[model samples]
Target: MDYKYIEQLIERYFACETTLQEEQILRSFFSQGNVPSNLSEYADLFRYESSESNIHLGEEFDARMMELVERKSGMKNKVVSIRGKFTPLFKAAAIVAIVLTIGNAAEQSIGNRPSEGFDDVTAINPYIKKDNISAAIKVKDNTQAETKTVVKSDSLLIENND
Candidate 1:
């Protein structure tokens, strides 16, 4: 008779504070066709739930659902295998990338490098004659030999002073 309790329960439901028993009471009350005029707006909502609760999916529904699931599973396996098929290509690409990186670094190190050692100064200045290197070495040996003789002469002077 009184709709105040139903209005209170509906408010509590919206606020998420209503218990399950209170919700059930509201659903049962609104499922009846004799709801008051002011509560008519909520009757269709509660009646729809009561009608939906009676629906039962038969074997035909289960068979159709299984078919759809099998189709989706087949598609999923195909996509997974497709990705697996590309794994070798990805590995080959990584190998090529590593080789290219190493090759580039080797090329950069070798580039702009000077020629071999300067054993012959002629390599540095090509106009110099090959025979000049031997001449220079002889001059260096003679200078070193003269320096040793001067040091020996100094030692002899010190021994005489002693």
Candidate 2:
């Protein structure tokens, strides 16, 4: 069979003008081992393609990759668990701090109060004037004189009747 079309495609492949499908056709045709003497130089290129097509990551590589993925996932879970577990404790500590601050403020207010218990009462009655005392004494003496006059008048009327 004539290989002129295949040779033309191979030239296009070297020029980087062949599509992937065209390159695949060239590799398939060269794999049959009937390549002409003039095209033997391109055998190595097609053989390299075949070998590359057969290349694969082994089971060991897959296992290592899976293990790495699992380790990363586990570390993420650990971080989430740590944050979830400590959130409540952090909130409780904040609440306790607020309560202690309020309690301390109340205690300080009670401790700093004025020591004098009667200061407010004394504030209501600031000073006793001398005139107010004299007025009270005069009213007392006027009531006593009125009582003596009533007693003397009753005694004089009883003597005149006897």
Candidate 3:
């Protein structure tokens, strides 16, 4: 038997260059039990393809699939009220309001209290002693007193000269 055409079709089929007609021809050729010994290796592949092509879904396939889908969706169709949906947002808003109120009260209390640490300059500064400040005040007072006496003396001299 001349199997040159069958061999060529099989090569084209493996190379993915065979048309649907050529593939059907290959399946028909292999379906016959009298395939040549040299081409027997590809017989199972074409036979499996032919057998799988005969397989199809039964009439109840769609109905069974819809039933399973409805059964699962019945559990998923839970009802959520408007209040239930907004409960988390309401809780978060309440927590924020409470936190802000407590923060404002604490700030007011701290602000109203006397700030002893900031009011006393001596507590903040170790280099400036009370004695140094008192000495500086005394020097400024003495300078003012000396200036007043000098002005009085000058006025007396001016009156005598007149």
Q: Name the best candidate (by TM-score).
A: 2
Error of 3 at 45 (Å): 0.4
Q: Which candidate comes out best when scored by lDDT?
A: 3
Q: Which stretches of candidate 2 lie over 4 Å from their true place?
A: 114-162
Per-residue CA lDDT of model 1 for 20-119, tens digit only, reads 8887888899887688998788888878877888999899999999999999999999999999999999999999999999999999897647666445
Q: Which of 1 and 3 is ahead in lDDT?
A: 3
The CA lDDT of each predicted structure is 0.86, 0.87, 0.88
Q: Model 2 compared with the native: what TM-score?
A: 0.64
| Per-residue lDDT of model 2, residues 45-67, tens digit only | 89888988898989999999999
lDDT of 2 at 96: 100
Question: Cα deviation in Å at residue 156, candidate 2?
Answer: 41
Tell me the TM-score of model 1. Answer: 0.37
Off by over 4 Å in 3: 65-162
Output the TM-score of candidate 3: 0.39
TM-score of each: 0.37, 0.64, 0.39
Q: Give the Å error, residue 144, model 1.
A: 24
Q: Per-residue lDDT of 1-162 in model 3, one digit per residue for the tens?
A: 899999999999999999999999999999999988999989999999999989989879989999999977765654345567889999999999999999999999976765563235565576787787778779999999999999999999999999
User: Local error of candidate 3 at 162, Å?
Assistant: 80
Instruction: Give residue 161's error in model 3 in angstroms.
Output: 81
